[model samples]
Each structure stands twice: as C-alpha cells, then as structure tokens.
Target: TSNAEKELPDAFLRRCVFHFIEFPEKDLMARIVRVHHPDLDQKLLDQTLQAFYSLRDIDGLRKRPSTSELIDWIAVLRRAGIASVELEAGMPFLGALLKREQDLLVFAEA
Candidate 1:
C-alpha cells in the first residue's frame, strides 16, 4: 500500500483497469487461416503456417507478420499458383507478409 501510494496517485490509479487475454492457440490460428482460404489444400495450409510461425521466430524483425498477413500471403500464393509453401517459394511474395521495407530487408539479409 505504501509503495503504491508513493509510485502512483489515487486519482491516476482510479482510471486504470486490468484485463487478461490469452494468446491464441495454434488451432485457433489454423482456423483463422482456414476461414481466409477455405479452398486451400490442407497440406499447403499446414506448410504455410509452419513457415509463417518460423518467420515470426526470427530475431530483429521490425514487425512480425500477423495472422491476417498470413491470410494475405496465402492468397498471393494461390493467385500465383504456388503449391509448395517453402521459404524460397514464398520469398517473392513477401510483400503480403511484411509491410515495411526495413522488415523485408531484415528478412532478406537473414
């Protein structure tokens, strides 16, 4: 109580509220992908998600691609008739996943 009083004024604290949100699970993410691309082959969906998650794990990305970005990327892949969802195959269509030039360059150099 003393620490809280010392660090924060009562007036300021009165306006604050806490909420918890659990990270979306893999199954949820998969469902998001499916919703965006219902006609996408199951194997391709799985492979693309694996690659997308792998990209998120890379260090120093200015911004990691979101599930929405993944959907767009998959759409791009389908439009280009890319069957395999490997890193190399998806490289050309990276614009869908990464919106910033720095992020794209960082990924390219990585």
Candidate 2:
C-alpha cells in the first residue's frame, strides 16, 4: 500500500519532468498529508489549501493548521503556491523521513 502511494507521486513527477513542467517546492506539503491521511483526497487537500489562503494575507505567514503540527505543512505549501504539486507531496513524506533537527536540513535538501 505504501509503495503504491509512493509510486503514484513518483510517476507524476517523472511525467512532469518528461513534459518539461517546472515542478515547484510546494509539493512538499503532500508528504505531511500522506503521513496523517495517506488516503486523503487531492481535491480535499486542494480545498483545505484554498481555505488556507483565502483566510490569510498574501504576504502574511500562516499560524499553521489546527489539526496537527504536521498539518502546518499545508500552510507551507499554500505559501509556496500550486506550481509545486510534487514538492507538496514531499513535505509530509520527507517530514516523516527526517524527524530530528539535524535531519530537518536533509529533508529540505531532498
């Protein structure tokens, strides 16, 4: 199941690169969503994200999601915008991959 989830994203990125899309950094948030709600709908995530931005200022920093610290990820991605769908996925996935303060840098690096 986990592998399937991972591959869905891997395939999307490979396709993006093939098509010459400029994948952005926002995709990182998807990682956080996968951790809490692996089956979370991309559409609902989109809605949650829209709600996120609609509630805040364009240049303002979000206070973070109320559901979980992990959900703070949704904020990170929203701030980055939609061009980075792949990076959105990476946020939660990599967040899980690197929990330590030291590894945090690695997660960002990845």
- Return the TM-score for each candidate structure: 0.72, 0.30
Tens digits of per-residue lDDT for model 1, 39-110 = 888888787878888788889887788878888898988998887645455565888888889888888887
lDDT at 92, model 2? 35
Pick out the ten consecutive residues of candidate 1 with the lowest summed lDDT: 1-10
Measured by TM-score, how close is model 1 to the native structure? Answer: 0.72
Model 2 — TM-score against the truth?
Answer: 0.30
- Checking candidate 1 for backbone clashes, the offending pairs are none
Candidate 2, residue 78: lDDT = 46
What lDDT does the true structure give each of the candidates? Answer: 0.77, 0.45
